[model samples]
Target: MAGAPIYSKADLARAETYKARDYPANVDPAIETLVREMMSGFADKWTVTILDTLWDSGTLRFSELARQVTGISQKMLTQTLRRMQRDGLVVRTLYPSVPPKVEYTLSPLGMTLGAAFCNVWIWALENHKAVDDARARFDEAE
Candidate 1:
């Protein structure tokens, strides 16, 4: 082909390094379960939102977090926090006071997850206009 790109030997090796991996013939079931659990946490919008909010606003009390997250119900927030705690993403602290105050903060693993998601948030903000334009064109075409 006249316009086809040509790759040097070094370019071919670099491209090979970037290629996707294939699982071995005897794959471990535990690895699959772990990946499934990780994907579920990443797929949940509420989980990501809570993590992002916590990442931005240090440690916050339950009421403060609820307010910051916006649109999250008390019950749903409670559930999400519990699930995050189980996954070792968030830490919950209880103060033995007259009213019994409770606070939440991201754990070390949660901080890492938040850092990874920051890139995604940045990409979304940068590409939102293009995405909206594409959606409009598609809608107009239909």
Candidate 2:
């Protein structure tokens, strides 16, 4: 850790200015913990897409599922499947075959969450026009 560039002049001055701004000294402990916990449960687009795909089909081969989802690479698809399996959102099974066979299906928890996602998506579709108008207005503002 020797010569690790400890606090260059610019960095030290930025820290001082941030401190001088006198931002809120404290946040509600409960709100802080709640926000952290809530945010930690968030999933990105690819993960949600995989989950949604599995929800649409009870079980599917890896390649077939990838076909159903647009613009997903084999590497990314495999990685996402493994992560979902590790998280207990998906169950991956391998079958012996001349070319090797595999299948993926949602676990109980995955199904539950998938159902929730479906509801949220349905609501979005139902309000698509409103949302589209909002987006249009937002872009115009920008």
Candidate 3:
């Protein structure tokens, strides 16, 4: 850890200013905590996939979403949806019926998240070949 690069917030802010991009000099603790929590939640594959599916397909029932998100077990889907709902990333609706009727859609908060993730999709599309080649080289070396 001795040789590890040490960067201060000032340094980061300076770098951002050099690039003419906005950087918060004083980040609020609450906002930082929320960002960390949301990032941790979105780090998983299923959550990201579910977000993408919902973004593309709009409102969908549980079974429909399950089918769209291939390879996710019903239990896993249920758990993921529950987490998303709890996190305010998804909205769930239930209607009275003989059995039951339920649907899921992205909340306003979730739509903002989806928009933010669009930048990630753009980055992946731009750098996928470079990433793939790097992985292949690393595998060969290993």
Candidate 4:
């Protein structure tokens, strides 16, 4: 406890003020629609896994990406990559060679999204045990 950090009352008040700001309720309809569409891309389990894999590995060829993503079917990977490319989250490059190599990398927008999602990953890591415990308790109750 001695080494634990403490927040002053002023710090707590400032944090509360920041948290109380209601930006989402007043968002423009078009902007809300666009945000929902963008967020839906991440609603799929495969999309988040692919993004996380690419974020860590950077510029992987199609086969390498498929392998890294683990359990992802070739068809699903191709479809997800194409959708990501269309959404500007990933850039797909094709080499005009005899073998015709293709590679996928996160676009600038994808990098930004990955950065934002890092906080979510951290939160999950921090709370994973608590979540598992809660689920176990709920199951026991049932």
Candidate 5:
């Protein structure tokens, strides 16, 4: 946490190659491609982490989510979940309690992307040693 950036040779190469691609403004990535990319990164960012946690746990109380993910403020998580709901990536259900109850889960469409996330999870579990080794090498380098 104290020092240099961590990236593998392949990571750096992909970064450069993606930067090198030149497509006209009219040439957009396919929707499926974009969706797959997002799904694959389901554990990499706060918003994605929120989604992936929900994916694994099924419907979860709103407070339960806030307690699990570190460093996410209540307002921020609420906003992210709202956006996912709007985008059809998540479903929100509210119950009329004496106070109120709210739960969140994946939509059927979201379930379709679960396999993509599962693959990323499996790869991360399998190759985290490589990631740790890269971090060590990076920290030791000039």
Candidate 6:
């Protein structure tokens, strides 16, 4: 932990810009319900991983996607892709040829979602050490 990298103060300040300044007194129930549903969907680790991979790699074949997203089983990847496709997050292209060809890419909707979540990735990068130190302290106290 001693050699852990630390982000510059400017970087931290930039990250803070994304935080909500204030909330309206009145909230719409329908909007709150939609937000909750989306949060739960994005909460899946595999879903996030797949989104990041596709965002970086553009279009990728099924097997290649599996290779890029390490630790995801074929079954899990298939299920995650199915859910993503169903939710209009990814565009799956099927080519009719020998053995059949398929590729997955982020739809325009998915790209926007990826952009929205980019802030979360930046936050994690900046605060990972603080999180680790907190965990270490908590563990030692136990």
Identify the candidate with maximal TM-score. Answer: 4
TM of each candidate vs. truth = 0.75, 0.64, 0.78, 0.81, 0.63, 0.77
Candidate 1, superposed: residue stretches over 4 Å from native = 1-28
lDDT of 3 by residue, 1-142 (tens): 4333445687578678878967688999999999899889888889999999999999999999999999999999999999999999999999899679899999999999999999999979966876686677667666
User: After TM-score superposition, what is the CA distance of residue 28 in candidate 1 from its true location, in Å?
Assistant: 4.3
Report the lDDT tens digits of candidate 4 across residue range 1-142: 4323345687578779989987676789999898899888889988999999999999999999998999999999999999999999999999999899999999999999899999998979966876686677667666
- RMSD, every candidate, angstroms: 5.8, 14.3, 6.0, 6.3, 6.7, 5.1
User: lDDT for each of the candidates?
Assistant: 0.87, 0.79, 0.90, 0.89, 0.78, 0.90
Q: Candidate 2 regions off by >4 Å?
A: 1-42, 140-142
Score candidate 5 by TM-score against the native: 0.63
Q: Write the per-residue lDDT of candidate 1 for residues 13-127, one digit (tens) a residue.
A: 7668767457487879999898799888778778988998999998999999999989999999999999999999999999999798999999999999899988988979966
Candidate 3 structure, TM-score to reference: 0.78
Candidate 3 at 38: error in angstroms? 0.6
Model 2 is weakest, by summed lDDT over 10 consecutive residues, at 1-10
Candidate 6 TM-score versus the reference: 0.77
* Winner by TM-score between candidate 6 and candidate 3: 3
Clashes found in each candidate (C-alpha, N, C closer than 3 A):
0, 0, 0, 0, 0, 0
**Candidate 3, position 126, lDDT:** 68
Lowest lDDT block of 10, candidate 3: 1-10
Candidate 5 lDDT, 2-113, residue by residue in tens: 4656667987897799788895666456966875766554544876787678777888888998887778999888888887787687889999996799988989877766
Which wins on TM-score, candidate 5 or candidate 6? 6
